[model samples]
Target: MGTADAPVILVTGASRGIGKAICELLATQGAQLVMAARDGEALQVLATELSAHGAPEPMVAVIDLADADAVAGLFKQVFNRFGRLDGLVNNAGVLHEGLLGMIRAEDIDRVLAINVKAPLMAMQYAARLMSRTQRGSIVNLVSIMGVNGAAGLSLYAASKAALVGATRSAAKELAAKGIRVNAVSPGFIDTDMTRAMPEAAHARRVASIGMGRAGTPREVAELVAFLLGGQSTYVTGQVIGIDGQMVV
Candidate 1:
């Protein structure tokens, strides 16, 4: 068991990219983590690594975010094991790009199920746990595309946009109960998702950014760490852009 002061944080999408980065940074800070992802192997690897480095061995949950029941059970397990949850990072999401008219109903359903509904459901359960303690923080991983329209990513943008609105509304409703909710909108981060873009299209996107480069997952993770920690006690119901001035 972890010390009382050690925060118990649940992070979805913990297998790779930004999610992995967030887990790494928080481990260094001595947070007890519940890492969730569909990739059980990767999650186990991460859990072992964090343990080897002196952090508590993180609890790894293999879960498909599309299953609403599994999402709810994840929280139930967290509360049952840890006794309380101090933070939640809703980082699991899917990105599907296609012309508006060409997008299929199934694709839209898949994207929204993971990107929008899963996080919303996870927050619902996390809030229930936090309400009992009357304190905790929730950070939803939104996107810059959600704030600014992108031609080929209408479905993804719409889902993220909905999350942004939910973040604000949840913040208001939970603030009085000592829970804070916010979002991090990363712009053109160098993740596998962005790496798959055609070279020319990728260059054009990077060049358009004021920084002239794509942000690293660690950079985005740092912002998440700050928000989850005490440094941002006054911050809540805000959508912070980590796009290197790309969306300002």
Candidate 2:
């Protein structure tokens, strides 16, 4: 358990990759974690690992963010368990690539539900709680695909672009309430999702980066931590990209 005075943070998609890295880093800052994801087993394993390492014991929430309604349940859990939320990382997202003609209706629904709707609703819930205390920070995980526009990822790009807009608008609306909202738009991060891309597509992505390599999850997490932490208190309504110079 963290100290009673420790900050409480809710991280969606907390079982893997950038989400997992965010949890680990935030825990080190003495933040009590509400780790939400679809993978119960993975969440448990990570909670155990963090606890063993002397971080605060994490509360795991196994939920499929694709449901969209799950965001309400997650916020309820947070309020009932912790009574307050000091930070939120909306990191749960899905990426389905297909040529425009090949895209299915189901794919659009699933991707939008997870990537856009859930996060927006999560922000709604978090905003309510944070407004009460007059303190909070929210970091939305966006992507360069949304800004730079990927060929076969039109739907995914649209969803993320929507979030980028939401981030800025939320920041404006929430600023007077002492709540902040920002986005971290990463490009070509080395995660399981990206690794699963077809070889040629993956190579093409890497070849466009000025760094000549994909970024790491930890690097993205570091930026999120900064935005959530006290280091960047004056920052909000911004979409910061960590793409290593997308030369494309």
Candidate 3:
């Protein structure tokens, strides 16, 4: 176990993929983790695995971020358990892929709820929870879609773009309180999120990557780990892209 005084960081969507990788890496570094996801079984398994690896057993919150009430309850539970939060990784999001004209209004609304509103609600809680801390960090996992609008992802793109703006604004607003906020805009990663695409669509995405390959979840996890650690004390309010040269 790390020093009993080690800071606790919360990671959303910790059931698999990038969120899974982030929890694993941080756990190995001995950070106390509060892992939240919609999958209770997955969160329990991951928490157990981390505990077996010498990391503190993660506290699990199986709550849907799409619900505002649930978001509030999550923060309350966190504060009740940990007393304070040192970091929050807003990694939970959804993408309803389709051309704007083809996507349903409900699909668009759901995407906005998850990809945009959820993060905003989490940020609000983090801001309040971290207000008194001597220092804290918040990392939002954005995407290249936030910067370069994708052809068939109008709703997704708009949501992430809004997240980027929120990250920037949050950083500036909270800096004086010793809070740092930033984002990581990943290109094409070989996560379930991307793997669900059709073969042809996947190929097109691969071809667009300047590095000629998709990134691994572990790669993105490392960047997030760095941002959460004390090593990044001076870095905040910037969106670091880990696209393997895709978004130049």
Candidate 4:
């Protein structure tokens, strides 16, 4: 049973990169974390470290978001164990880059399943729990590519764009219940995924950004924290970009 002062937050894709950074910062804020990801070992390691550092030992749900049943079960476990859900961060997603004509059906399905459907389903369950208290917040991790066009990232962009639209609709539907939903559209960020880009391409991308550098996962995590916390109580149904003014 969690107290009011110690809110319970469920963060998907919480094993590494941006997800890991979000969990790390939220731990410091005294949040009782429910970490979900396919990497059980990594999740356990993070749980151990956070516990050792004085944060509450996070509840780990090792799940493949591609499996709809597994995603639903995760929420069931969260409510059964914690009795409430105060916040949710839909950070689990896949970026499959392929040109429109060359893209395959299976690839599109996989990307949409993990990126779009998973978040929507998570929101459905989270909203049910949130409705009980009439207070909760959700932050969906969208992408700047969803807002702008990218040549080789058509499928990824489509999935993200779908999430962005859903974010607004969900926010409106849940707002009357005192549940706030919003999105974070991250631009090029310094993460394991972005680090794999070719040197020339990465350099060109960075040079184009107004900041002359890629944003850090920690920077995005900070915005997520603000939205989930009390500071953004009046903010809802909005998508804020953390792209260093690149998209502008």
Candidate 5:
């Protein structure tokens, strides 16, 4: 069981990249973690690593976020185990690239299911737990493509944009309950996946950023930590971008 002194925070998509960084930073903040992802092996590795580093041993919930029943079960376990939730990071999302006209119906459904529907459902569950305590924080991971536009990524952009609108609405409706909701829009972040682009292609991408390089997962995680932490209790309903000032 977790004590009130160490907040119980639930983070999804927590096995790699920005999600992994967020987990590391939050651990340093002394939070009791509940990590949810589909990769049982990877999640366990991270849990052990964090515990070794002196953070509370995280409770790992392996579930497919796209399944509504799995999502509900995730929350049910949280409530049953900890009986409270102080924070939530709706970070699970899928980005499939394709031309808008040629995209398959199944592809579109998959994108919306994980990107849009999962977070929406997670927010509902978190809100219920948060309302009981009259306090909590939610940070949704959106993208620059959501607000701006991207070729071959229209479906992904649309899904992220949906979360942006949802974030604002959730903030307003939950404010009276003392829960803050916000979205983090990352642009040209330097992750293992993004860095694998051909040299010239990567250079062009970085050249567009005023910082002369792509933003690191750690940089993105720091901003997310602030919004989730007590430091930014006054910040809510905003789409804060960490893009190194990318022109896109």
Candidate 6:
């Protein structure tokens, strides 16, 4: 059994992208992991990889984040098996492209359910767990689009903005319990999502970033580890942008 000295970090959406990187980083630090995502086969593979890298085998929960009942079940499993949760990474989200007028209501609702409602439920449950221990951290994966409005991303931007607001309120409400809440807003990153974008659109997006290139998942993961770890004990309710100076 992992003890308090070994941080117990729970990462949602750990099958790929930023979530995958975060799990690897925390695992490298000897943190016991409780990995959750919809892809069961992928999550099992990642758990094996983490164990190979010297981390204890991670507990896996394959559930759709959009399902509120499934999310509640996940937390229940965490409490039952882990007994304490040191940190939570609410990194599960979906991005649908289209202007506000062009997007269908169903698409918007889907985005909100996954990106906004899922995280909110996770936060609510995590807060309860942390309050018991009087120590924990929540690192939200927001987006740079939320900071500066991006064309054709109205629904996505609005969901992230709502999360930013939730992060602040949660930070304040849970401060006394020693729970630090913050957000890491990533700039354009080279991932499965971006690789799927049209070539011209990707190039245009890269040009807007001062760094002239997209960020890697590992870079964002490093920042997330720092915030979730004890290094930022005094930091709370802040949104740190990691977008390669894209919005500056």
**Candidate 5 error regions (>4 Å):** 1-4, 196-200
* Candidate with more favorable, higher TM-score: 2 or 5: 2
RMSD of each: 1.2, 1.3, 1.0, 1.4, 1.7, 1.2
Clashes of each: 0, 0, 0, 0, 0, 0
Q: Please, what is the whole-model Cα lDDT of each candidate in the order they appear?
A: 0.93, 0.92, 0.91, 0.94, 0.90, 0.91
Kindly list the per-residue Cα lDDT of model 6 for residues 125-203, writing each as its tens digit. 9999999989999999999888687899888999999999999999999998899999999989888878888899999
- Give the higher-lDDT candidate: 2 or 4: 4
Give the 10-residue window scoring lowest on summed lDDT in candidate 5.
189-198
Candidate 3, residues 111-225: lDDT per residue as tens digits? Answer: 8888889889999998899996758999999999978898998888999999999999999999999999999999999899999999999999999888999999999999999
The global Cα lDDT (0 to 1) of model 3 is 0.91
Candidate 1 per-residue lDDT, tens place, 1-248, comes to 35566899999999999999999999999999999999999999999999899897799999999999999889989988988999999998888889899999999889999999999999899999999899999999999999798999999999999999999999999999999999999999998889989999899999999988999999999999999999999899999989988877
TM-score list, all predictions? 0.98, 0.97, 0.97, 0.97, 0.95, 0.97
lDDT of 4 at 182: 97
TM-score (C-alpha, index-matched) for candidate 2 = 0.97
Question: Model 4 segments beyond 4 Å from truth?
Answer: 1-5
| Candidate 3 C-alpha error for residue 50, in Å | 0.5
Q: What lDDT would candidate 5 get against the real structure?
A: 0.90
Clashing pairs in 5: none
